[model samples]
Target: MDLLGGAALALGTVVVVVVGGGIVALVVVARRVRSGAIPRFGGTGIHELTRRAGTLLVRLDDRLRDADSELGYAIAQFGADAAKPWADALSGARAKVAEAYRLRHALDDAEPDSDRRQREWTLQIIALCEQAERQLDEQDDAFTRLRGREVSAEGTLRELRSRIEDARARAAASRELLSDAAARFAPAALAAVADHPAQADRLLDDAAVRADAAAAGIAPSGVSSVSGILAEAEQIVHRAGDLLESVERTVRDLEAASAALATRRRELAEDATQARAEVESAPDPDSGAAILDALRELEAITPLSPADPVRELDRLDEAASRLDLALAGSRNQKQRFAHALAAYEGTLVSARSQIAVVRDLVAGGRAGVSARTRLAEAERQLAIAEAETDPVEKLDAVRRAVTHARDADALARYDLGG
Candidate 1:
């Protein structure tokens, strides 16, 4: 009897364990449903719900299409002699029906992945179908009111249909114009605005996509939305044309500036050569040593190159200004060097103030890496200037320091817009 009792107790324990495991599994499934990882369709399975939704949408679309066709037939039989009020009512109803059908088809094709989204879409399609039915009922009422009147409802609908056809035609023409602009001018704009060709192409491509959407919205039956879309297409086409023209103008301006820069470069080279000769032939070689050093500094700067012509031109201009100062020292000798040194001392003071301001800007995150680098270089140059024994070399170093400090300040405040 004791052995029998032990077996019964072990069997009860196993049953309890199995029940606990089942409960845990059920809790996990409940959490998944709540989190939307698994669909909560009440008692209905996901596949069954989706099939029902699709069937409902298909039936709604077919009914809406049939209503639209009946209206179209009525309009064709009536001709332009229909009363204006009745025809307007009929056309509005027809448009609503067409929109409903379009919406239904779009939803059907969407094939929503989530159960929540699928349910939402299904509800929306049902609402649209109901709205379309109301519109058809209103159209019927309008026809009944106008029955036996001198103006037939059919005549007015025919006139309305013709107007819609004209609007569609206009929309088609606008679409064609946009397409032509994309084909003809987009590539040229890309080539002309080499610096920002991607931006140009993106704008054109976006406009093209909009145009295609507008074209698709243009139905055989009139839709008020088509009018707005056509207007948008026209505007997009005009914008593209303007963009191409602007790009062309910019290209021309750059070419002209390049030619002018070439001429200026040649002039600068000649002046530099003449200045070097004057310094070398000076009677007192010791007095002209600073001027000779300045010349060497100028020579150390890289020459103008095609890769960065604008920046190279700026460098050339700075060099030319320094060379002019050196040329003056070569002619006046010691007295001139003294005067230049005094001037450079003032410049050094100004530069130090500018560098301090730039440092603050850098700390505030308003300045860039280039600004910090230039500030460091300016400080180094200032130290070299102070340590120099010769007045001429001191003046040259001070001037270079001032230039670098001013450049750092400018860079700190440079506008990215340009």
Candidate 2:
């Protein structure tokens, strides 16, 4: 077309046809909207989600503004995202929806004070539980030591009882010997009192009598020691008669005293045996070694792996507290020697058990020699403690000695030979 004129004519025809098609399309869209004949939002992916949510919120807001009573406000406050329309709507409404989502995300990201408080409370409760458990373990150890002390007290009481019984028996035997010495006058006194029962009773009851029978020639008289002299004569006569008695009677009393002595010795032996057994069965072990091992293991643990050392450290603290309690209560001269021996034996037992299962640590002979030296030192302390006089002071000294020995052991080099 001669350029511009041809182009203008073609553009006018195109513009008219475009205008007619746009009018028809607008009319069809209007009819569909009015009749509510459009497909549901979920039926197609064509709907603008933000616009729809805005329209729903606007309607929800309108309901809030036109409330007949307070019921509408309550409903709006507790409305669910599922119940509201999420179809096309205005720009401001869409922006509001976007802002609500942003607020929800921000709340999710922000650390709440409530959550931090809950965590703090949880930690505090856990700490309290641990403290209680440690206290319980301490009490258990204290109870065990108390029982040991009770056993030791019982042993001491038994020794005192044996001494008392021996003293009583010695006193009785001395009396019997005195009686034999006094009975010598039985023959002479009996003949003199043959017709008088009262006089005979007096002679037999001479210890309690205080009459002048000895001066009247009823018996041999001695003013300086009348009772003694009379008793001596009676004892002579009794001895004479005893000499004439059968050997079997003498043997019988002798056997009884010997048997009593033997029974006492046997009972003492049994009590000693029982005390040894009680200590040997469940011997107290050192808590330090176990704690060290647990610490080593804890050093190797990683995060989020469930091998947290918090609980382990708690157990170790509990063990340490228990040991402390046992040490506090049992710290005495009488038990210091026993405690040292127990500690040494515990070290040996632990070493042996560890050597059986683990290698390299003790296999190099370094740890073993140091461990042995420590055991020997402990034993020496035990002897020293036993020889001490003051119980509390002796225990304190022993504890210091043990601590020093442990420090030495930790730093010492191993030597297999002298």
Candidate 3:
């Protein structure tokens, strides 16, 4: 009996030891998990952080826009002196949001970052956006209080009425400009601003209705009661005014492009003459062929007929550039550099024009990720080229910009159904 009791005691001691060891292991594992040494199943990792950052970025951008509208309303009603602090806060917030966007764009680029680095960038974006939100919230609270103070409703109504009259006149001018553009250019070229006149009219109508509402509400409660309505009316009028102005600007750009087309044609003729001289002196096959091609392209352009000036300019610049490159071996170093410097200007212009077109499509959500990435790169290269002092390097940078711009354009058009 003594031997059996001793055996049972030993087995029970072993069981206790084993159970304690298991519990100890579990405790260490839990600690590791809590400390992030071992990731939890649904952890806040890079992917999660990226998604949250994107969402927060968009929300912060929208808030900033609204804050801008509020600032404008505050200034118009209470004057710039009263709105200075809010404006300062808004400026700071905009800076923060812009930095966040820059970081996000970097992460979205082709180069891949390690998981740890990605997490750091995403966290920074979230932090910047949150800071902006907090700053805007504080200003918004102060703005609300400011709105509650007494303001002159009668004067505000008078200002709004005058603005509405101005907007109406601008809208009329925009309609006429659109008619002129329609007669001169293809319908597709004016698609961006085609509805501006009608949209401005609609906004004006809404502003009128809100202005009338504010006028009615002003006499009953006070300026505080109608303050929001007045702000809405003012903002709508501003939007209408902006739309009308954009139409005028677009038309002006088209007219400037027409003038530029004529100027560029004359320049191309001069460049072709220079290229012919170079080819005749050196007798290079490629140079001679390039000059002929460039001259043919120049002859193909008709200034009198309806034309896409930007496209024509691009074609002429590209042809001239090819001729310059072909004759590069024939020209002296000084002449080559001079020609490169001039060619860089035309290429830079073409790059900027293409980038602007792609950026607009991206803003309209008609572009995909590929297009956006290329556009970002193109802008970066163009900036570098603009700051470059070395003629050869600047030319190289501008050519890269043109390449990326064309790629973005092609991708964007493809995404828009080819």
Candidate 4:
């Protein structure tokens, strides 16, 4: 009897320990579910649950980041380290329940009457959400997992397929650009290879890799190029899709950047407005004249077009998306923003060149050469800038051209002949 009782007790102890562990795991997962944390198909329960310190949660968070912009969204997508559908449904339901709770709680503060009905309605939503949450539990062992990178992850994978098609157009464009660039350099490349076979071979491979990566990293909506270039570009494109880490990072940075831009813009606009108001209120012609003369001198020197300032502001607006995404998702946007700024700097350089041409022509008595001529020159420069494949090199060329134009015009106006 002593032996029998001892064996029974041991059996009971084992059962209790097993059951207790299962319960604890279930409870933690349940809390995660309630907090809008879905067990990512491949992500550890706690690992995927916490918000990434910087860019880890980009995949989950960037749902509505750029819902209304030009770079908006690619399309329906997927990923590797993604959870199953039921989990997503649960997460969505959890979000709705959270919203419902807030609405219901607010009901208690209401004056009365219909507020009760409102609270009751919210309760219904909570019930519905709970039901959906239960479905997540039911499907637990039935789901599959994938690698966690954006390309292979579940959610990102679906997204990848969708964006892949969209990327088709961009890929095509890149291919064309690469082809032209390759063709242009082919003679030089081949000749070098002929002269220094080993060196040429190495340079060609390096060139191919660099060009392809660049195209991939900055895959525009449409482009066309060669097969060799395409391969590199594809690899580069994948870089942006690296472990949804980039997405999360970009989203976070975009948030802060967007806020800063908004604050700065508001401050600048208000200051400018107030100063203008003061100037108008004074009603002094000489003061006005002084200001206008100052304005004229500045205009003659820089010709700050009404359109240019607006373009910069518009760029900020467009960039605000990157910001909203950072706030909502994840990304390393400073680098991207920096790249964009550099691209624009090149554009501004070209515009300054045209302004210089205008000044020079007027000064040198060549202003009568027809507006068509001036427009033609400006248009040609724009075409060249657009057609050039290497962003850095093309930008450099524009900067150089602009500098030359500016200097020549300045000389013509103040020193050369005038």
In terms of TM-score, the best-performing candidate is 3
In candidate 2, residue 124 scores what lDDT? 26
Could you tell which candidate, 1 or 4, scores higher by lDDT?
Answer: 1
User: Residue 392 CA error for candidate 3 (Å)?
Assistant: 4.3
lDDT of each: 0.52, 0.35, 0.73, 0.38
RMSD of each: 22.8, 42.1, 19.4, 25.3
Candidate 3: regions farther than 4 A off: 1-145, 148-150, 283-304, 344-362, 365-368, 395-418
The Cα RMSD of model 1 versus the native structure comes to 22.8
Q: lDDT (0-100) at residue 371 of candidate 2?
A: 61
Models 1 onward score TM values of 0.30, 0.14, 0.58, 0.19
Estimate the TM-score for candidate 1. 0.30
Residue 56 alpha-carbon offset, candidate 3, angstroms: 37
Could you give candidate 4's per-residue lDDT for residues 246-344 as a string of tens digits? Answer: 223223333333344345455434433433444454455655454444333322332123223322333443333233222221223554444434444
Worst window of 10 by summed lDDT in candidate 4: 67-76
* Model 3 Cα lDDT, one tens digit per residue, 1-418: 3322443454456445545564454345345545765433366767777788899998988887677567778776556666777777776777667667766776788999776556656666777788888998898888777666435676788899889988998899889889988899766556657887898999999999998887776654354456667888899998788777767766666666667667667776777777667667766676677666766666675654466665666777667666666766677888777766876766666677677667766765778999999999999999999999888789889888888988998898889885
Best by lDDT: 3
Alpha-carbon shift of residue 75 in model 3 (angstroms): 24
Error of 4 at 339 (Å): 34
